[model samples]
Target: MVAPTIQPSLPRVSPWALSSFWFGSAFHWLLLLLILMPADIERLVGSAHKGTYLGLLSGLGAVVALVLPPLVGSYSDRVGKRITFIRWGVAANVAGLLVMGFGLRAGFNVYLLGFLLVQFGNNFATAPYSALIPEYVAPAQRGRYSGVMGLLQLSGQLLGGVVGALVGTAVVPRELAFVLVAVVLGLSALVTILRVPEPPRQELPADTAPRLGWLQLFAQNAFFWVFVTRALFSLGQYSVQPFLQYYLHDVIGRFRLFGLNLGNAVTASSVMLLAIIVGGVASTLLAGQLSDRLGRKPVIFFAGSVMAAAAILLLFGPPFGGVLLLALVFGLGFGAFTSVDWALGSDAMPSRRSFGRDMGIWHVAFVAPQLAQTPQGRLLDWGNALQPNLGYTLVFGIAAAFFLLGVVLVQRVKNLK
Candidate 1:
């Protein structure tokens, strides 16, 4: 056989080279703290009732998630500089964090104020920041970039969990966690300010692209269904997440030979999260590669199956005794699904003219679940009335259903070559 000379790999932007990663990493760590805060705040307030507070917090976030992206993206495109919006957005997010931190320190009616500021700032920054990914990355390299992004996100979440565990173990005070969150976010903002190169202003063709009203654009896209399906997937996935630790502590602990320990609960949740991070990074990379090679629908089908399987396992049992190996099963499937989901979502964006606006609409699906938490909580309460495990099982089942629905909808997406 004749030998074929191999070409050297092309040099592109290093996935970790940009300031955005630093900013994004810190943003993720602080976000995880926010995730852990409801329970912490409930304990701080000397009230056993954390459900209503959490429900309201998540619901308001969902509302903001739905509204912010299109507004930010459209404006950014019109203003002709994405970074200008991103810079201001990060500043706003920092301001929001300061308010939240001060509220925590001052013993004000901080829950509502904290939640609202955090949600607004977080979404304002996130919507524009995410839109940049497609703008900067070449279509061919997107999967690798997405994988790197997912890996960083997961690592940041794990880092946050470690901090939470230390706090729970008396290694750090709970109040200090909020300070840590603020500092991390401030650092993330600084990184964005320093690192990401702002792209030049967009020049639209005189006649090819008209400045359409938001509602007009929303009404025109067939991909809108895909966006809604994505939102459903988000709703199902997150609806069960906030309560996972509670489940491990309350339900799984019953099967323990040793008594339930809070530290053990955090450890188990940390383990599950670690599994998710690992699986998610691997699967995301694989999905992106496969989507590029085998096409998007096949990868979507494979990923949907993995997601549904994970949901079923979590529904049936979680952190099952070391013997059953439940965590591994859930982690593998969940991770693969996430990888494909990012790949598919990125694949579905339209032309550059509508990219910012459409992407903002798509992201609404990602954040829409915050609103659903209120209804989910009500459903959970109703389920508790019937049986202890019924609510969680139902939630997991719905998550699986949404995953499947997302698969079905992806089949309808066109121009995804």
Candidate 2:
């Protein structure tokens, strides 16, 4: 039998509480190590089949991401708050890191297992963690929260890159890196658990509301479509991302500027990443703040426009000797998109009824993009063989179209009001 329904006013979230959200995101860069380990694995194995091995590992990780979230999110929803999963998930995450450390120390073929576990830990905690935003945050303050999170993400990426570079670039002492990452992740998890209090669960009309079929529940919510749009856009956006180093090294630096020389290629790639970080910081912060003042739609629209422009620049800019400027522009656009996109996603959820479950759906959008990489790689190889920069140009042009389509889709989502 259904119980009586009660709905309380949403709670006010403190800035300190919001800061913890960013703190958690900062720890996320550790997950990148999982993706990166394959290169080291290739060197260790002394095989020419690194691509196949990398694909298998990544594929397994993607499968884990797809499967784990719904189970974890549904469990969190049933419990009426996310803390249960959040606390334990962190413990499990640390344990996974320890396992990874031991695996590396033992010289076991454990990269695939460790990567899958990392994905599981990340998603298990991630969905439940994000659900807190819609429950506690005032819709009006989401912009500030989004901005801070963006800064945290960028800082985390920079820190991760610096750490990777500093680890001597040789074997990387895998066990040590794993241990340090575990410690850092644990510290961040502790901050979130102790500092941020969960919002009380809402009580909706239980008696009259019919049990919902998944499709029916989804059909009533326009937010799901927005999530779809977000996913498709992300897939299109990243179609060009993996090739950034390639573009800088082979096309811009080696072929065009340095006459296909290998020496200048590495330095150019490094400079491009630096440019990206700088531009990304500037645009993300600016977009987040602007969204706070002007409303999300306007900021989202502007971000889309910037992204489209950047995509076009990437396509043609290499030939004109403007690749660095294009790289910076692309970074700016991506920063703007990511900075506000999270809060925008939170705002569009159907309700706090199952914030974790909803957020799991949102995350699927973020993760699904990786599955497209294989096809994109094939396209790149084909295009590169035909003409220099041709593959990149086509890839980025498609990304631009996706951004433009996202702008149109954003207009259709009147759910925020």
Return the TM-score for each candidate structure.
Answer: 0.84, 0.81
Tens-digit per-residue lDDT, 1-417, candidate 2: 443221336546555555553554454442343223543555555334433344445556667677777667767777666766777777777777677656754553675566667777877887888777766677787787787777767666555544543342455555666676777677767777876766555566644334344576467556766686687667766566545545555555542444443244333554555455567788877888788787778776776787788778766545423766766776686678777877888787765566677777777777767666556655665676688767676777777887888888877776663
Candidate 1 C-alpha lDDT tens digits along 117-188: 666776776666666666666777666666566555555665675675565446756556666776666675
Candidate 1, after superposition: displacement of residue 224 in Å? 2.3
- Give the Cα lDDT of each candidate: 0.60, 0.64
Report RMSD for candidate 2: 4.3
Error of 2 at 59 (Å): 3.7
